[model samples]
Target: MRLALPTAVLVTALTACSAAPPAAVTPVQATPSSTPSVTASAMPRASAGAGEGLPAKLRFTQIAQFDKPVAFAVRKGDDAVYIAEQGGRLHAVKGARTTMIVDLSAEVSKGNEQGLLGVAFHPSGKWLYLDWTDAEGTTHVTEWAFDGTTAKQRRDVLTQDQPYANHNGGQLAFGPDGYLYIGLGDGGGGGDPQGNGQKLTTWLGKILRIDPRGEPYVVPEDNPFKDTRGARPEIWAYGLRNPWRFSFDKETGDLWIGDVGQDSWEEVDHEPRGRGGRNYGWNAFEGDRPFDQGVEAEAAVEPVITYQLGEGGSCSVIAGYVYRGTKIPGLRGHFLYGDFCAGWIRAAPVDDPARTVEVGKVEQLSSFGQGNDSELYALSLQGPVYRVDAP
Candidate 1:
């Protein structure tokens, strides 16, 4: 749903609470535990120079404009940036020319959170994928054969019935391992009343890994839950509320997720390469604190970053990428992220997330894009797309 905004900040203090033991194999869990906070004294010091201050001052140059652009993507070795609008039109923005690449407005749902949500290109650049909600509010991850100028031979890869209108986790990326990774939210109701987050049998509230080239899709043989009885074989990780956006560091292959919290807190989760089967406390925890009192969470991994929900008018976290592009030397190895409501962008070193610094801002920020050159771009639901350039 289109979220309402709050005008003020509500400070969030780190709180700890012991949870009752976890139930066997069922969904539901406690809020998570918080990691130790990093002191200001530990942060990288700002300097006056080019590429200075945590990564150098950033200039977001307006590169293109679209109709409610929600996601951006890049094809391998291609200079064009693909923009996906909530209304189901995909456009290729290359230099001064913008071309319509695809249109599915008739098939996409019109809800605030529904519609065309994410787009990605396969590593081979021959395939394009889209994650969107149908008219019935069902999520679909579809694939198409793309030959640069056009897309054809459409096929369905995965489908899930969403229980509610909001919290449709729509993020798709091809990981370093060459497998397609998909993020799904805990089937949308307040606090996961359906208990999908910790439920092994369901794909909801999980990050799934599969080879979309297979018929429909093929679960990787090495998937974390592939051999686990009653578990969805495609599941790589579970226990997430709403993973709005996620990306792999181009250089390190680490996974970074911006999982929107229920209330009070918002978080960014980081998982090192090859660490699958992680449970990021959802109903059980919200940004390192207990959320649902009745649910016992598994050994959950706490988020590396958390902030008050209304801190500086912040609402949902929009996860970006780790800057590895040569255009900004100081930005290399730093993870970039922002908030949907607050519209401010910040960056933290991959090695030390707590040592963060504000870098830029984009009003109505919906998503970020990393190009084939590894440079970054930010999208706004209001239409403008900006390229993050060194100032």
Candidate 2:
């Protein structure tokens, strides 16, 4: 929507998988699920091959296409991949067939980074979670029961009124800790029009943690600002401009965030498992550089890696996943990422041993999805979702 970088060095501002081959999908009556979230089992590592350590030669294969598909997810123990169309429908991509699961078109307003921006299946494989903006420009994190074809039993997990349409950081993921982590951008307009990033009273421009089924959604007691005065306890981390996409490392439990840039620098922020309360310095700074002198940066957690916006056809940085899939021998521990406009698919090792490597490029890359086996798939907003592969 918002026309939406890499490196190494291991500079420590540093704080900070595999599982069943998918069981049959079980439809539920959209009841509130109290079951713990699913954690990925460790995937077997790939043994080195002839091309091991060979210069990378990546290729893209189109698996499927959809209209304005912005987000996707795999069920806890199922192989079918569910895709979210911005106009408000979830589609399933399995083998040779594609089917629509649900439609919320009457409730969604599509335009300018607004719409159904994210989707996720509950750990029990029964419920489906969605993060999207409604026709009134309000953000809603809703849960519905999935019967493999239609969505039912709608439940509202959370909601926030947006001041502007753009910068609605609506990505959602259930962390290894069994809590849902939400990313929200500062209330849109140019440069954080409301200065929401630095304020503790609001959830915008912050990563929030909550239990979706606990008493109409309860904020976790362990959240960073739980006891802080004036700070909304839902905030797990504050001061992100627009963290469009972020995921938890299935094996290591680390959190990876791709925070979109304001003017020049796009950045990647990392946090170790079990750590929070760190400030990422949005208004005070942008991508490790002093930005707004008006507010001094205090104990800010700078990005581990950042790339200039104008480089490599770069525009907005789409923060992607750390490859733990065994299909690509050389991509084992590397964090795969790309840009919306530049279309170049690049990766930096999660361990940061080597500098960022340019893998390959594509057109209009919007999002990246992981299969049940941990393999990586690239979703282009234009239509084709490519499977990133190598010989």
Candidate 3:
């Protein structure tokens, strides 16, 4: 029951120029033309840390594989894992068995970085939510009821006209507050072309929180912009480029946002559970450094962790959750993350602000998921989903 807008109408709506002026912001650092070199020694290996008490020998095994699996969610009490495919399908995984739960290929727009992107389940386990790019290339957030075995009864809850396909942010999760939060990329093209990242009038380039129990979802009265003029009332935070993945610390409810960078840096921003309405630096700044000098006057939030694309032998940061699963007691409280191209998995205790030690490595880590038992699992773009257990 997702709503479909004609492609022509979407194009016209996105192209309609807005009269609002661009906010002053700093410019991002220039990207180098050549690819940076990575030494063989820089590559990571499986290594256990004293903090998480991981076993001496650790390895990963494939549980399932798909054409282009992008995101996954685990039901609270059920053993099945819900996997989202970029080609517009939701696959359910129970133990080693897999089955198709829903298909929306006709409504989905599959192109460069645009398709079925994210999925999540309500805490009550009664509903599943999906985020995707529609045929016209706009982002849509929809919810469907889960009747134990299959997904039934769909509802198109929210849709945002996208200017371009490349930077459509696609991560969705229900926070501890029982509110669903959706991430949207800055209207795409090169370098945030439309200047939507800092624009309050639009929901593009924001982390939006809404109560889905209402018709088409309702904006929470406590939203940051509840009293602001000309601002999208549902926005929880603004000024993000393309937040590819974000997660709530299962225990703390704090939010961890991984924003993809243009050329110089990849960043991870932390928002404590109750805080909202913050502005992350995008066009005016990349990471902690200033990009555009003009936007410095506007309040900007800094990332808790950042690394240069080339310096750390990494590119395209994939943000992950802190391990709170029971399988690896030693890894509990460790923040696990990896790079799309580097093919390395590393975990540093969340308590360690400096991230001094490495927990271990996983080859070609694509996405991370936590099970109903609180155990951690790692999905490989070209490999299997492995249970992150003690060696």
Candidate 4:
């Protein structure tokens, strides 16, 4: 729910304690990223050598549906795919049957961009994590003991007080190094009035890395700002407005982010494996243009791709994964992403991100999930979860 609106509309909605709802979306133009190129031999079989052309046809197959599914996760050695509903219930989908495995209806905050927004499992599959907004609108990243059949013994690993309801970046994932990574938005309000994006003292507008199994949590020494004075030691990257969704390449371990833009642009940022300490300029720069000339950012990383807002109704970028599954050979090496309002899913080759082709669409697209097999699934806020596959 990263939809933008006029100041008058925003104030009215906020006064009612509501977030900006979805609006019509349109097509947008993509700008190529500045990352290095990969050799043709490294590309998947069906795809023409690096940056050459589009891949074969692909389609979405309805695997199952749920009540406003926002995140999908899997447990190691388990055959079921777990979907986290915004209303605070975890559903386990095995073949055609769906079962409620964990319920937190009484615990979650209800509204746009809130609720059980993210779900992930420990690499060992012994722990389940939920990134959710509590009844008071504070974000609580909780850990639960799990035995595949049920989840119990919940404990809070991290908590942050949200300033505004909108722009709560609620996505979680385990990096290739096994550290839990969390995304949080700039304390909401248009134009970053709080100045959190470029501030190091707060966790807002940043990505954090920590070991959650510790008492509460442990900030890894390797984190970029761990020893920096006046900075939150957990921060791995900074200067983001609202990084709603991000993912790591399963094969290359490279990081990709879809940072929802402020007003004019939507962007996708890329960081090579282990390349921390990046400043994805926000409040200071939107897309490639300067937004706030007063704020200074040190060596900001430019977006690999950017699209204009309000063009063909395009709004709210949903960052996805680089396909590495055996089922979609043609999609291998291509990064998949979409817009929440536009509902169109497109894939751009890792080499040339500007040359994108529409792959599929999911109504009310909320997030994308990668399975244990490296396959992908797209979740819709409208209740359908589709598996990416060759038609």
Candidate 5:
């Protein structure tokens, strides 16, 4: 569920809607954004802070290994770590004691990027929210009350129809403003076939925000497009292709996204706290390049860092948190990231963009999780989650 599409990739996913689907492609047409302009921002190098990105070499000690683990969640003030497997189960790990909080295999779809993709605590850690694709390939967000003994009170929060099986960018996290943010792919087909990224009326290809505690869901009062005509009230940001992983800086509250490219590049986008409604050109512009010569919107934001890879070098970018942990004296304030194909870990300053420093590596790096105290861990696709440690 996390990758690129060839320029000529064929469609092979199930299309199950009664009426015409959003991304249904027969005769592809172009929908121009509100403003048609293009700007390719160059990566700028900045000076590093004192003792920042200074660890000569880092170590990744194996903490535990799980069955194809994909997502991770840690409760505030708790030592236990929750690991979600693509096989549909949540494992709670505290020291040597491991227990199953819930099993969702009966509910989630398997293979080709479908499974338990994300989990978030209700700020207070009293409620657990899970985002997964059901067996039929539709995205579902559910909630459960947690008290450490049993995960109770199952509640279905939201659902979205997926036209294709791939490109489900399922990453769930609560924003600094307290709204639940859900990242969804553009209904799956290659090259924004559905036009969901720019079409505000649909939930696909966009970032959605809702209050899960409400009857169905509550859109925040100041959500950017809440009152715009022909727009879905829950849409916060639009025009992203497979935002595989994203995180909010623990200290700055800014949003950082690792948007997998169409075929040539990978990017990391940043948004200042409270800044929503921004368009991140997808098919129109792919990571600082005019993908199809389509004019991009003037307001369309550019990525903070954009890098191209050779045929088999490194492609998909997996974004991680800015190290605000105290344990690693040198990594503080540096944003860490990796590639699914290339397991090497790298970091760059939040205030600075271009210059990057190599950190460490973990094979099949899928996602990174932060402990309650801000310590970081890398989840690998090939078993073995690693704890980021130095000295």
Candidate 6:
């Protein structure tokens, strides 16, 4: 869904409560389009202690593993988890069983930060979308039909040329408006060598929203540049460096973006849904500070929150969702995010003035997944998917 304007910020001070125990796991049908049937009440909040602010009593159990899993999405009514591996394979996990759903090794361009990079499922669960780099080093977004057992009817919907292999931001998701949003990085090489971030003619360095349900994927009529001259009508937001990942809050529809920085800072941008046409200062500014004097004053946008590279014990921030899951009441309304390099997990309650609190920590956290129930899952780069539960 598109976001409205930023609203008033809300702050609350939370104290420690006991960790509520976990409930028994009830088996549910493993279908491709149905939501998972796991129902557990929120765990009691545990005391907030030292060491990165995660509750001292929190722990995680490995439920499943994936090989080089880069992105994942869950069906709205299905217990199954769909994972995208960097090696060009899509895998499905359901009730203790995992299987390959699609293989694209021949079409994938695998390397340093390249390959199958993102995946999303249609709200209807009948369609799945994938973003990846092709053998020619360009990025392509494709859609596939999914039956209960396998993926068929592959169709390439969007393709963009790439200058380098590294910064091909291949993340895809369907917004609340039912449009597929694709994130692309500045044409690779260090320092925006191709100058794509500041250029509006190319699809690179921008967030694009398209109606993939149509042939050739039509651009939404209201896209910011639909009537502008020499601009890609599909562009939603521009001037992004490498927006590795982005997500919309299920409740508020706010877009949380994690854009990788050049040499100094990594940023997290919060764009209220529906607020397009804003330039997320990239080559002009890095994380609210001027990076290039010439472009800094050119009406550039700013990130709602940002962190320096080494501060707060984090490296690359993995943008995540605000908790709406019933499994953890205290975690409700909290935005749970992690550091890909530091393997640290932290939660900041949305709009909470206490913006620096760390709610929990997961070891070797590579990515976060959302289930059909809206519960969050933490995936370790090595393997194992842990349901983000309370203590």
lDDT digits (tens) for residues 216-255 of candidate 5: 7788889898889989999988888888788998788999
List, residue by residue over 265-312, the lDDT tens digit for candidate 1.
788888999899999988799887898878878898988888877667
Off by over 4 Å in 4: 1-57
RMSD values for the candidates in order, in angstroms, are: 11.2, 11.0, 11.2, 7.3, 10.6, 10.9
Model 2 Cα lDDT, one tens digit per residue, 1-391: 1222111100110011111221222221211112211111111222234123523656677677676567879987776888887668778878767777777888986655777888877667777889888998999999988867678889898899998777888788888888888888887876676788888899999989888876568888788899999899989988888888898888898998989887777888888898988899988888878878897656988787687766654667787888888878788888887777677767766655124666766665678888878888887665566677764
Top-lDDT candidate index: 1
For model 2, the local distance difference test gives 0.73
lDDT of all predictions, in order shown?
0.79, 0.73, 0.71, 0.79, 0.75, 0.69
Better of 4 and 5 by lDDT: 4
Candidate 2 or 6, higher lDDT?
Answer: 2
Of candidates 3 and 2, the better by TM-score: 2
The true-versus-predicted C-alpha distance at residue 86 of model 1, in Å, is 0.7
Candidate 5 has an lDDT of 0.75
What is the descending lDDT order?
1, 4, 5, 2, 3, 6
Q: Which ranges in model 6 have alpha carbons more than 4 Å from their true place? A: 1-58
Per-residue alpha-carbon lDDT of candidate 6 for residues 305-385, written as tens digits (9 for 90 to 100): 566664544556677777787877667776776666555566665664125345555544556778878888776555456
How big is the RMSD of model 4?
Answer: 7.3
Candidate 1's displacement at residue 199, Å, is 0.6
